[model samples]
Target: MSPSGNQDSAPEGVRLQKVLAAAGVASRRVCEQLIVEGRIRVNGAVVTELGTRIDPESDLVDVDGVAVQLDGTKRYIILNKPRGIVSTMKDEQGRPDLRRYTREWPERLFNVGRLDADTSGLLVLTNDGDLAHVLSHPSFGVTKVYIAKVEGRVSAQTIARLTAGVTLEDGPIAADKARLLSASGEGAGSLVELTLHSGRNRIVRRMMAEVGHPVVELVRRQFGPLHLGTLPVGKARELTKLERGALLTLSRRDAGDDRSAGDELSAGPRSQ
Candidate 1:
């Protein structure tokens, strides 16, 4: 269908390939290949044409004889989240939050994981549930990198203790890697970078506090293959094609699919 919402003037629904891709079957290019290969069916009939369109809200879309759900638009966005704004979609106190940044977005979006109101930096907001789950799942071992400013002179002992392990209220936690970004001569306040796979609540803060170098400021530098880059504070943008493709590939790998990259990307829709 055309970008305009005139159903009668143009087509009644979105293209078959777009429908499949938006349904999390695969990327648009791969979804087209699936259609050409006769793997996609609509209302029990094989659809091989790339120009086919159907109302996802009403039409029955099937892949390999199994129906696919096209309930809502799928969006994947990156935000250079600002401090003091909660990572959640909503706040009970009606204070600043992610919703304020995504208020113009049509689809209801949620953060892939929590980032405390006191923290800032790279945060992912998405309506795609499968990718979100795989990205945040601890078993996947996706690394979250952070750059933190701490109060006190950072010592080699501090780095060792952070990397070795520090017991928090929840359990024993350890950084996969930690290094001081500033020289010791910089004095009491120092900048440090940390890498870890844990997603526990307020973990970075707790770990730093326990190590005797309480965090004065914290910012996430990276999440998996994505980075904060030059995105201004409180601004967000849709993930680029390349970034989206790479993330989908990582999610497939995490799900234990051993198919070749090409085949895996052309794979069918996931069940809700």
Candidate 2:
């Protein structure tokens, strides 16, 4: 009578195959193959037993020669980017990139959007692919706010033109909101704040230059539900639980509004 108990149930701890799968290493079936091939090791010992259970918290897991942790600690980070550093992971001309700042991070992370090397401000980096996909998609319409210091004084007509639309080499683009922050002075540039949702390359600089007020400096202050705050330049930190929850909610909401039956968010880098 099998002791009159739940005979077909899983035992304590999670299956080794499941742990590997949950870590985004491979599928369950593939993980099983990895286990059978003696590629998986737990606590420095090769594990080949089928249905083997182990505690993820205490046990050290490694796949092949690389250590892997499936603890579901998805990293959501906000970096206060500084000028003269690229936003990408690698650079061809031996220039500084985001990798320089995130060398200590264990998990593989990607930047959500781009900030030009010449610009500075808030930037989001994460390993959560689904949330990144949703946030980066053009359809989500995530808002971005920037403060710009231009070479010369800006005019009401220029603001109106920017509010209306500006013709560029690519096409036409306009700011959702554009307002002056400070007046012009003797050889001092004017300060302006602009808000928009476009991800076009160098859009802000291009628009300002088109109106004869080339951007001397630019800083992104906000993006979607995240803010730059008082974080120092060239520093990175993990997102708080409340911020992560709110961002996840925003991403899910944007995804839910899709009309297509089988549409999936594209996981690609968005420009700012």
Residue 141 displacement (Å), model 1: 1.8
How many clashing pairs per prediction, in order?
Answer: 0, 0
Count residue pairs with overlapping backbones in model 2: 0
| lDDT per residue (tens digit) for residues 44-105 in model 1 | 45678887777676555666544465665678899988989977777899988788788778
Candidate 2 residue pairs that clash? none
lDDT of each: 0.79, 0.78
TM-score, candidate number 2: 0.68
**TM-score on alpha carbons, each prediction:** 0.69, 0.68
Off by over 4 Å in 1: 1-72, 184-188, 258-272
- Tell me model 1's lDDT, rounded to 2 decimals: 0.79
In TM-score terms, candidate 1 sits at: 0.69
Question: Which residue pairs in candidate 1 have backbone atoms (N, alpha carbon, C) closer than 3 angstroms, thus clashing?
Answer: none
